[model samples]
Target chain A: MSLLAEIAVSVLIVIGASFALVGSWGLLRLPHLMARLHAPTKATTLGVGSVLLASMVYFFAIGKGVSMHELLIVLFLFLTAPISASFLARAYLRAHVAPDVLPPAGEQGWATFARRSDDAHDAPATSATRAPPQD
Target chain B: MSDAGLLDHALAFGFVAFGLALLLNLLRLVKGPTTTDRVLAVDTMVIDVIALIVLLGIRQSTQAYFEAALLFAMFGFVATVSFCRFMLRGRLVE
Candidate 1:
């Protein structure tokens, strides 16, 4: 492989790997579920994208022709990350979040809490551990 | 079969970093304050494993791992969606 291609592959891999590590660190250490949700979903996707891009470059530089399939992973991930994240956020809100801390969503209140008021009666699911709000 | 010296060293660094990422995910999975935290950790683990597989393919100088990596990613999404669905509605579908 050419020196330029080699350097590009190495740099991309290092960047991708470090980002993945840091994102997971954030995921593990963040104070709350909503805060944790912001961690790995975006940064690590970019990390994986860079790694895949490096693979494509390495292969093409060695004269194996451009490989397009890796892009499919990138496209699919970007499309689905937000959707899955929203689903997770909804799950977190419904299972543990108290209604008063959230802004009023009119008569319906927040969709997560179906009780429609800031009353203390809504206890959410007993089976799930409560997510403590950041103080 | 990687012949480039710098590339080889970089790949080793990547292997260590991603492996450590998996360990961190495992820590969160075990020490979750809520079920959603565990689910999120699992999702991140899947992404980390995908990166490892890609790096392995590059290191081995072969294309054999691509299909497995793609399928793993798809399964990760499906599993995450199902987890959320179950968590939100207490059921997978209407």
Candidate 2:
């Protein structure tokens, strides 16, 4: 490999590794579950995405031609990261979050908790409705 | 220093740093305040493991590990989705 290509690969690897560390740090430091969700879903995607990019570049530099398949991992992660984040957010809202801390459920009554509100008097929304306003 | 030696040193540094990140993720998984937090930590850990495996493949100059990374990604996504589904519905499939 040329010196320039080698340097590029090294730089990519270091950047990717640093981002991974930062993501994990955020996970530990963030105080709330909702806030913590942001750290892993976003930072880790960039972290591993770049590492795989480095791997792709390194292979190409060594003249075995690019490993086109590595791109699939990057693509897959990007597509699924949002799905996981949304699922986790919904799960939190339904299972643990107080609705008053949320903006008004607006017209539809927050799709995730709709069924529960109809049957249970102490359903999530009812409790939120009774609680004093949170600043 | 020779280019190969320098590259080797950099790769080693990356390995250690990522390993530390993996450990931190484990700590979060254990100490998380809620089930949602633990699930989030585990999801992040799987992604870190995937990154580490790819780096290992790079250091060894072997494409063999690529398939392993791909499989891990698939399984991790499935696990995350199933866990979320269970948390949402209280059943894996219903």
- Native contact share for candidate 1: 0.73
Q: Report the C-alpha lDDT of model 1 over B4-90, residue by residue, as the tens digit.
A: 589999999999999999999999999998989988999999989989999999998898898899898999999999998777766
What's the lDDT for all of these models?
0.85, 0.83
User: Between which residue pairs do clashes occur in model 2?
Assistant: none
Query: In model 2 chain B, which range of ten residues has the least summed lDDT?
Result: B1-10
lDDT tens string, model 1, A1-135? 889999999999999998899899999888988888888988888899999999999999988888877888878888888889999999898878665566656653455645323323333443332232334
**Candidates, DockQ:** 0.58, 0.56
True contacts kept of each: 0.73, 0.66
- Can you list the residue pairs that collide in candidate 1? none
* lDDT, candidate 1, at A30: 85
Off by over 4 Å in 2: A116-135, B1-3
Give per-candidate clash totals. 0, 0
